[model samples]
Target: MKNIYILSIGKVYRKSNNLYFIDKDKNKRVIPIEGINAIYIMNKVSLTSNAIQMILNKGVPVHFFKEDSKIGTFYYLGSLLPKQKKPSGKVHIEQVKAYINVEKRSEIALEIVDAIRYNMIKVIEKYREVYDYTKTLRNLDVRKEFEQKMTDWKDATNVIRGIESNIWVIFYEALDKILKTYKLERRTRRPPKNEANTILSFSNALLYATVLNEIYKTHLDPTVGFLHEPYEKGRFSLVLDLAEPFKPIISCRILIWLINQGIVKPEYFKKDLMGVMLNENGKRVVIKEFESRIRETIKIKGKGRKSMLIFIRKQAYNLEKALVEDTKFKAFRLVY
Candidate 1:
């Protein structure tokens, strides 16, 4: 199954069980609902009640994004199928229990941090093989710095988060040195400061939604998180947690590839009161590449090969197993 992205102004409606999208220009396109895994609306698109009901009944999630906002709204019907009918309350209970237990929560938080650190190193290594960024990486001493910070880590999630943030600072510094066209001096959002920051914000939003979609298919509660606190209402803290490792592997890598290959250029971005952001065309380009990257297959040792989307789902399942069955949870690691 694939995702359907509506990037232009359109009206979506259902006719005789078929989903169709008609752009403002009256150009109609047939959307195969059965083949759709999700729907992403990146622009102003009106949806008929019938169309919304059909997708909901079909168990398809619709993610909506505003041009100015990175994190948007997610719409879905909750637990429609028999398999999803009774999501194991046992899993939810265990997840909350683990969260309340300081030692267990700390262990999981460290695991997530380790996964993020491991992938950051992998990303640097991959770039070094193709580009002469070794000097920048060495100067940053990412691994050594992270190790030193870890030495002072306590059973506090806030400290773990602090260490994670510091590592990203080093990673971004190396990234700025490697990039020829863009500079990400520091990570800024809610109006990303520059082109690199703009793309990073957009990509991370997409990844958050993708991980949340996968979480819905499992018994894991998206509300409670190990690394991040579940303090904000309506915020999927667990999705934020799972999205950490993937940010380096998926969002950051895609940003690097797009900039270096010249697939995304200055013309793709524009500045407004909302700060620098991808134009309509820019959004389409980024969405196309983001979808392609997630669908791309990679080989795993015992698992043979799997798409990035499958890996995401497996991560959720692994978390469920760890919480409910008391099994060891193995976070997804990028394999060269």
Candidate 2:
């Protein structure tokens, strides 16, 4: 199953038992509902009630993104599987219980932070082979020293977050060195200031949505989280938590690859008062590459070679086991 991205102005509707999309230019495309994992609408598109119902019944999610927005809005039907139907409630209860228990929450948060740190270091190390990032790696060593003092901190969560933030700062420093055209002085969001920040913002947003889709396949609650505080409104904090480690492994790597390979050019972006953002052409190229990368297989211990999407779903299952079964929850790590 693959995700179908609608990057054109179109109307999607159900015809007979099949789904079809007709663009404003009268171009028609058939969408195979059974083979679809999700639908991402990044441009102006309309979905008929019948089409929406069809996708829901097939257990497919629709992710909507506004132009130049960081995150996508999600719409999907709740789980329909008989086994998940009853266990989902129990799993959610266990999830909330783990959150309310301070020790458990702290443990989970620490694991997440460790995963993030490990991945960030791996990314820097990978690029160091081709680029002169000696100063950047030395700065990372200093950050590691601060991370060692984390145990003595009173607020473990806040301290762990600080460590994560500092790692990102150092990682961006490394990126600045590797990128020939773009200078990533600092990480920025809510309208990323430069091309590097724009790519990072867009790529991370896609990762968040991908993680959320995986979470929907499991019994875990998306609103309740470990590393990030759970909120009743806005942000799915749990998605934010799970997406942290993968940001370096997936999004950051993709950004460097796209820019360095000349797959994404300066002409692909536009700068306005709001900030720098990918143009329509840039979005198409990035989304196509992103989808291809996720589907590519990698060798993972015990699991052998598996696609990134499977690993993401496995991570969700790992969290569920940790919460409900009192098993160890290992965050996904990139193999160097």
Please report the candidate that would top lDDT against the real structure: 1
- Write candidate 2's Cα lDDT for 1-336 as tens digits: 788888899999999988999999999999988888778787778879999789878878787766634321223223322123345788999999988876778778877777776777677775645345544444444335445766754566677677667767667777777776776678777778888888877778778878988888888999999889896457888999999888887888888888888777878888877678888887777787788778989997677898988888888899998998876678887763
On residues 50-132, what C-alpha lDDT tens digit does candidate 1 reach at each position? Answer: 99889888888787766534331223223222236665798899999998887688778778877887777778865654344
State model 2's lDDT.
Answer: 0.77
lDDT of 1 at 177: 68
After superposing candidate 2 on the true structure, give the runs of residues whose Cα lies further than 4 Å from its correct spot: 68-87, 129-154
Q: Candidate 2, 280: how far from true, in Å?
A: 1.0
What residue runs in model 1 are displaced by over 4 Å at the alpha carbon?
69-84, 129-155, 232-234
TM-score of 1: 0.86
